[model samples]
Target: RVMYTITKWIEHKLGLKVNATKTHITRPNKLKYLGFGFYYDTKDKKYCARPHASSIQRFKRKLKQLTIRKNTMALNERIRQLNQVIRGWINYYSICNMKTHMMNIDKHLRTRLRVIIWKQWKVPSKR
Candidate 1:
């Protein structure tokens, strides 16, 4: 009933149409908003926020573009660019209680960096 009233209010009072296909009525913990997912942490006995899987995948895709092997950008310049992007992303998502996810991403990022360095070292003697 409340949902119907709110939908009507949005359409009539606010002069905005609500898309039934996109509308969802669910608990906060079951909803994803702005790339973040909320869930009840049984161990902590509290609600927590974390990046959704899709959000993480999107970040990884962006990182891959930045770190692609044939970019031709100098190593220091590439690192500087990567740092700028990573800092902004971390600052935004730090509100989420996702230490494990962050750690895993860090590991994956390090591996990518190693691969980039290896590719740069084309000669076997350089390795």
Candidate 2:
């Protein structure tokens, strides 16, 4: 003898197409027409206003924080590389420039080198 069992099957599906460029949600009060002025009113009835949703406000706040974090990380990495280059230059000067220091070597060269290095590192000020 054999025992039989029955089972039910279910299927579900959903589709989403995200267009980032058109995602902005505009509010009614912001709309304006030149000849019509802000809006039209019939008796006490009028094209009225509605405030932005709380979710949009929170999303903007979080987006700003993320942007700041990304910029800080990029700047920190550039500073780290600049420090390494400066250390190499100091070693070169100690081994070579000092041994070959000559009056004929232009003082302007040192100033130029300093400026170039500062610019490359994106430093704020020369002094």
Clashes of each: 0, 0
Query: Of the candidates shown, which would achieve the greatest TM-score relative to the real structure?
Result: 1
- Model 2, 72: alpha-carbon shift in Å? 10
lDDT of 1: 0.88
**For model 2, where is the 10-residue window of minimal lDDT?**
1-10
For residue 45, give model 1's deviation from the true position in Å. 2.7
Model 1: residues >4 Å from true position, as ranges? Answer: 8-21, 124-127
> What C-alpha lDDT values do all the predictions have?
0.88, 0.37
Taking all chains together, the TM-score of candidate 2 against the true structure is 0.19
Which residue pairs collide in model 1, if any?
A: none
Candidate 2 backbone collisions, by pair: none
